[model samples]
Target: MDNLTHSLVGALLGQAGLKRKTGLAMPTLIIAANIPDIDAIAVLLGGDEHLALRRGITHGPIAMVLLPLLLWGIMLWYDRWQTKRGARPEKRLPVDAKWLLMLAYIGCLSHPLFDWFNSYGIRLLEPFSSQWFYGDTIFIIDIWLWCALIAGVWLSLRGERRGQPSWRVPAITSMAAIILYIFANGLITGRAEQLTGRAVQSQFGIVPAMVVANPVPVQFWKREMLWRDSNHYGQGVFSAPDQVVLDPKIGQHEMSNTFALAELSKDKNAKAFLFWSRMPVLREELREESKVRILSDQRFGNPLVQDRFRVVVPTEQDAK
Candidate 1:
């Protein structure tokens, strides 16, 4: 999920009654919600280093515990500072250490839960185990979710301003609706994967080793399916009973030589990409007498969008 969604979720959680528990509760939730993303600093290192680190340690089990504690302490210090300066708002509830810590934990945990819904995947057990997990239920940027969250927050604010009773109801309802929406998408993804897997086997006469059904933005019932077999890879758009195979190609041809590609995987960038990629494919090109191999993850690799994480390696002869 994008940072906006994360922030909105945090704000909604605060509106859903958590704000009454302590001073600066809303800021604690909003900030903690986006805290794990501090790992994004890896992007400054350039290359695919960010890809290798994005959802790793900062989102792992160890950091999950420590990060919230840090946020809790910071929020408490800020509250004390405001009090010392005589700038604390009269309407602001007194800060409670226990409630602040609890909100911090809730906000921090929400980050990974939302991230798990997208195809980008997350390393929940990183450091301990760098395994990636995917929910395949929502697109990275979901307009519907944005609307739901925004509307809920807007309505809640309006109610509060109007001095209406039960101002928190809208936020609570929105959170429940979002959960149901996610559940529905999960069911759709599972069914679409099953249909795509069966259709691929029927059309290609080969069982797919893995199949992923990624949600299409704005099209709730539609999914983009990618499947792989030992020798070939296939992609298609699936809508319930119908499956359209857009591209089916021999997977072996993706690489010029299996041995060369395997050897190239030893590179640090290549190793990181392989570890992170869920549906990897390769393309080889010849420049002069050298072999240029480009490895990509098929999940996000399309003709129009060449934004897939790629690791280019030239053979030793070409390096010369």
Candidate 2:
């Protein structure tokens, strides 16, 4: 999810019990919550790739617990500063370090958690691990969630007269959107699974070892699906899903030789390799001397989001 989305979600959730009583100041909470992500600015300043470090050190367990404690201390320190300057004191900070820390963890951690759900991955366990956790959920930016959140924000901001009903509009609206997305994705996942299952059965005459389904957004009426062999750490699909062998020329996919079994149909010797039930294809790394040529997805290497993976062909002598 985008930074805006993260801020909005935290703001809306914090607004639930924070309508008036020196509330979490959902707006301020939004800032304090996202402040931990300031490390991202380092990427813009220098061309260094640091997503692994940023997501690792900043979103790790230590920062998750310490963030709220720091914010609560700042709140108390600021009040004393204002009082000393003879300025009228505003409301006392209602939330304690414990509560603030919990809120901060929830808000700050939301970034990596939500990012993981999208095709993009997240480094939830950093320092010891640079492994990215990816979830094949709804796209990072979903239309319905945005519209609902914006509307909720608008509705929550309306001015009310004395004795008028106070609407926690933002909280309610966001909750509704979250609920809808959960079920909507369930249906989407099912449709993707069904499509891939048919393709696998057509080629192999048996269910595929596993299918990873990714929803491609073409437009409102038309939808595109990507099917990858199930590469997962879990039992079901949606783990580390691979790529769909979409014929770049034509978008149509069939259960027969036209596309699904096209390679097998062409190479009689390679027929056994076509079925997902058989051994998965081990991709070859094209090497030049010591250099390798391959797409990032094809390479058996890990690069941070910022670093570009170089492709080089091996030299003649290097092959020997």
Q: Would you list the C-alpha lDDT of every candidate in the order shown?
A: 0.85, 0.48
Q: Candidate 2, which segments miss by more than 4 Å at Cα?
A: 19-24, 41-48, 87-99, 159-163, 201-211, 215-224, 227-294, 298-320
| Candidate 1 clash pair list | none
Question: How good is model 2 by TM-score?
Answer: 0.63
Error of 1 at 204 (Å): 0.9
- Which lDDT tens digits does candidate 1 get at residues 1-320? 89999999999998888988988899999998999999999989777757888899999999899999999998888888988999888898989899999999999999999999999999999889989999999998999999889988888988988998889999989999999999988888998888888878887787988889978778877888888876578788877545456556545525345786677676777777777788877777886767887878878765665565778877656766
TM-score against truth, every candidate: 0.94, 0.63
- In candidate 1, where is summed lDDT lowest over 10 consecutive residues? 247-256
Global CA lDDT computed for model 2: 0.48
- Write one digit per residue (lDDT tens) for candidate 2, span 1-320: 67777777766666554434343446446765576676686566332234223455566556666665676677656556766897633554554545654565566666666666655455566655655564656666666566666666666655222333655755676678786775566566666566556755564444544444443332212123433334311112222133223322211122222432443333322332232111122222544326322212211123443124322222223434
- TM-score between candidate 1 and the true structure: 0.94
Instruction: Superpose all Cα atoms of candidate 1 onto the true structure and report the RMSD in Å to 1 decimal.
Output: 1.9
C-alpha displacement of 184 in model 2, angstroms? Answer: 2.0
